[model samples]
Every structure is written in C-alpha cells, then in structure tokens.
Target: MQAIVVIILILALLLVIFTLQNAMDITINVFFWEIKDAPLVIVLLTCLLLGYLIASFYFFPKLWKLKREYKQMIKFNSELKELHELNHKNDRKPVDDNSDPEGIELDDDDNDGSTFFKD
Candidate 1:
C-alpha cells in the first residue's frame, strides 16, 4: 500500500512537470460551441478525470454485484452451520440416570441371562 502511494506521488510529480512544459494555449471546437485559448494543462487534467470517471462507471456495477454475492454466501454458510449444530443436538440420545460411568450396563440377568448367583 505504501509502495502504491509512493508510485502515485511520483507519477503526479511527473504529470505536473509535463503539464508545465506543455502550457501552450489551444482552441477547442465543440458542437456549435467554441472554447478558446484554454491551457493545455487544464485540458489534459480534465480529460484524465473524465476518463477515470467513465472507467469507474464501467466497473462499479460488476464490483457491487460480486460484493453482494459474497455477503449472501456468508449468510448461507452461517445458516448451514446453525442447522448442523441443531441436527447434532437432536440426534444425541438421552442419557440414562442408572447407567454406569464405566459404560457397563448391569441388569437382573447374570451369566447365560440367569438371575441366580452362585455363592
């Protein structure tokens, strides 16, 4: 970013020098109207500004559409994540209060599903 700013400043300095050197007066003929004895520097700068504005008009609509699409995708991804979390919450089985922490489930049955215990 700093480099870009430095380059722009250098270009602007060069443009100033070029404009000063080319300061000859010139006449412009528009449709049924004539502009007389305008400075070359002002003409060049005006043309540059107009060209920048025209190019921005060409590109800004597409840029705005892409930005809108990016925001929509982000919203969709967040909704999808929320739904996934909700699904995981619903899919979980309810814990039994009588179940052992060691994962061993003991009922009345013993060996061979028999309730009798030998002493």
Candidate 2:
C-alpha cells in the first residue's frame, strides 16, 4: 500500500512538472493588474495554497465546534449512565422469570384484557 501511494505521488509530481515545463508562459491577475513571466508551478501551487487557506478559514471553526459538541455529548451520556446506576443501586433484586419463583404481575389494567370504554 505504501509503495502504491509513493508511486502515485511520484507520477503526480512528474505530471505537474511536465505540465509546468510545457506551459512556461503565465499571467498573474491581481485586482485589475496583470503581471507577466510567472512560473506555472509557482502560480498553480500558490492558487492551491490560497484555496486551502480560504477553505480552512471557513471550515476549521465548524470542525472544531463539531468536535467539541461530540465530546460534550460523550461526557453527558457517561454522566447519565453513572446517575442511572447510582439511582438504581439500592434495588438490586433479580426480577426475571427464571430467577423469581413467585411470578410478577404482567398487566397493569386489572388483567381484564379489554378497555373500559369498549362494548
């Protein structure tokens, strides 16, 4: 996998160098002013860097906020679990059918199996 990645990176770099060598002529436009004779790779890399900078500036804060919210949610869930355990610690009796000989109530509505309002 590492070798494949290295080969791909080398090919990409060679492609960029070949493209740059082929296009020696480049123009730079900055706020209505045109500058000439700039190297193609320099301009291309500069544009790439500028794009990355702009995107990072716009997106990094949101990424950090998401990370913070995720951490807070994890902490809140852990605290909720701890509170539940603490609250239920006093009553630790086994209530399963296999454990209890005397069966517990299965229904809460007087076991009539019919609604009071029905005919």
| Model 1 agreement with the true structure over 1-119: per-residue lDDT tens digits | 99999999999999889988999999988799899999988988899999999999999999999999999999999999999999899799998999999999767646566455544
Query: Pairing residues by index, what is the TM-score of model 2?
Result: 0.64
TM accuracy, model 1: 0.61
Residues forming the 10-long window of minimal summed lDDT in candidate 1: 110-119
Per-residue lDDT of model 2, residues 1-119, tens digit only:
99999999999999777776767767888998998998787787778899999999999999999999999999999999999999999978866755435555444465666766675
By TM-score, the best candidate is 2
Positional deviation of 89 in candidate 1, in angstroms?
Answer: 5.4
Model 1 regions lying over 4 Å from their true place: 1-5, 88-119
Cα-based lDDT at residue 117, candidate 2:
66
Give me the candidate number with maximum lDDT. Answer: 1
